[model samples]
Target: MTRTKLLAKIRQVFPGHDPEDVQRVLDEYAGPERLRVHLAILKLCDEDRRDSPRHYVDSACQDHRDVLAWAESPQQLRPDWFSLSVTERAKVAKADRQQYARWLAR
Candidate 1:
C-alpha cells in the first residue's frame, strides 16, 4: 500500500495514539515485509472474524515470540499469507524465512 494508505490504516488501527508515534512504531516493528504480512493477515481476519487491527497489534505487542512462532510455521498453512499477491508473498516469505533461519542459527 501507498504511504498515505498505510498511515491511514495505522491511524485507524491505533486510535488515540499520536500518528507520528504510530508511524515510528510501525517502522520499528513492522517494516516493509512484516507490514505486508500484517496487512494480509488483517485483511483475511477482516473477512473471517471482523476483528479490529488493534486486536492483532495488541497480541503481537503482548507476546512477540508467539507471533514469530506462528510465522515459523509452514506458509502453505496460512491462507492469509498466501492471499497476498505473488510478489508480495515472495518478499514477505523470503524476508521472514531469512529472519527465522537467523534465529535458528543463533
Candidate 2:
C-alpha cells in the first residue's frame, strides 16, 4: 500500500536485502510501480534458490539504468526494454523526463 508499509514487508521477506538498496528503489519509483517491483522481487525469492536477496534489488534497478540510458540517448533502443514489467516501463518513462530535466539544468 504505502511506501513505509512496503519497505517493512520487503525487509520482512528478505531480511538479508540491503536497506539502502530498498530505499533507492522506493525513492526512484512511484507508489504503484514500487509495489509491482516489490511483488516481483518477492516472487523471485520464491522461485530462486539463492540464499541472497541482493540481486533482487539489482533486477529492480536494471530497468532504471536501461531507461536512463535510453532517455540520455533515445536513438538507441535497449534490447531488453520489452522484457520489463508494465509498471517498470511506466515508472521509467516518468523518471526519464525528470532525469532529463536534471541533466538539462546541469
- After superposition, the stretches of candidate 1 with alpha carbons farther than 4 Å from their true spots are 30-35, 38-106
Residue-level lDDT tens digits of model 1 in 1-106: 5666656655554556676765554444453356654543343333345434454455566665444445454463466875788997887778767854553333
lDDT of 2 at 59: 50
Model 1: which residue pairs collide? none
Per-residue alpha-carbon lDDT of candidate 2 for residues 24-101, written as tens digits (9 for 90 to 100)? 654555334656555445444534644444565565566644333433434235577688888877776777566545
What is the Cα-based lDDT of residue 85 in candidate 2?
Answer: 86
lDDT values of the candidates? 0.53, 0.54
Shift in Å, residue 82, candidate 2: 21
TM-score of each: 0.36, 0.35
lDDT of 1 at 47: 35
Best by TM-score: 1
